[model samples]
Target: MPAPEGFAYVVRGADVVISHHGRPVTTLRGRRAAAFLDDVEREDPQELMARLTGNYRRGNERQARNHPRNRGR
Candidate 1:
């Protein structure tokens, strides 16, 4: 959401280094790295990297917020 920001990546030989807010988070290699590169050119890089690094939401926030326990907050 919010057009994920502060995500950057680097191509290192056969590996792809992904960083968030300037800190290294995960690295993709071989087939994964190649796929990432190809997708980056056609998709939203920030969202892609966020998902790969486990930093993106799982689409459950709205439900959680509406749960009975969270009502009238």
Candidate 2:
């Protein structure tokens, strides 16, 4: 498939380039390059954030609910 509007990709002699929202983020080389590129483009921001931060934005409700700082005056 073609790259999305805000994204771009290129297939050099033996490498695959990948970008996100238009910024270059990764490059894959060798036989599995295409698969790697596919995976990169299909990544989910929410899943990534949850993996990195231990909680997704929607899952932060508990903290906001119990924190006095977030309480309405």
Candidate 3:
């Protein structure tokens, strides 16, 4: 199927990254790729990527705050 307008994808080795207007929105590989393929048109790609990637970003923020470099102010 043709990509949605303003949305595009590129394959980097084993992974395919879906981007919106030059910003990488999400990555697809293995099961995630298969699962998202069915809902590509039905869902908001930006919202979906945010929901998925947001979790990791939150964790990284927590880890950074707890790191030794951040200790003692």
lDDT of 2 by residue, 1-73 (tens): 2212434456787886655555666666785675654665688533432333233245567788879987773
Cα lDDT of model 3 by residue, 1-73, tens digit:
2223456667676676877668887788987776665665689764555555442234466688889999877
Ranking by TM-score: 1, 3, 2
lDDT of 1 by residue, 20-52 (tens): 989999999999999999999999999999989
The positional error of residue 67 in candidate 2, measured at the CA in angstroms, is 11
Winner by TM-score between candidate 2 and candidate 1: 1
Q: Which ten residues in a row have the lowest lDDT in candidate 3?
A: 50-59
In model 3, the runs with Cα more than 4 Å from the true position are 1-14, 18-26, 55-73
Model 1 collision count: 0
Give the local distance difference test score of model 2: 0.54
TM-score of structure candidate 3: 0.41
Report the error of model 3 at residue 7, Å.
Answer: 8.6
The number of the candidate with the highest lDDT is: 1
Superposition error at 58 for model 3 (Å): 9.9
State the C-alpha lDDT per candidate.
0.93, 0.54, 0.64
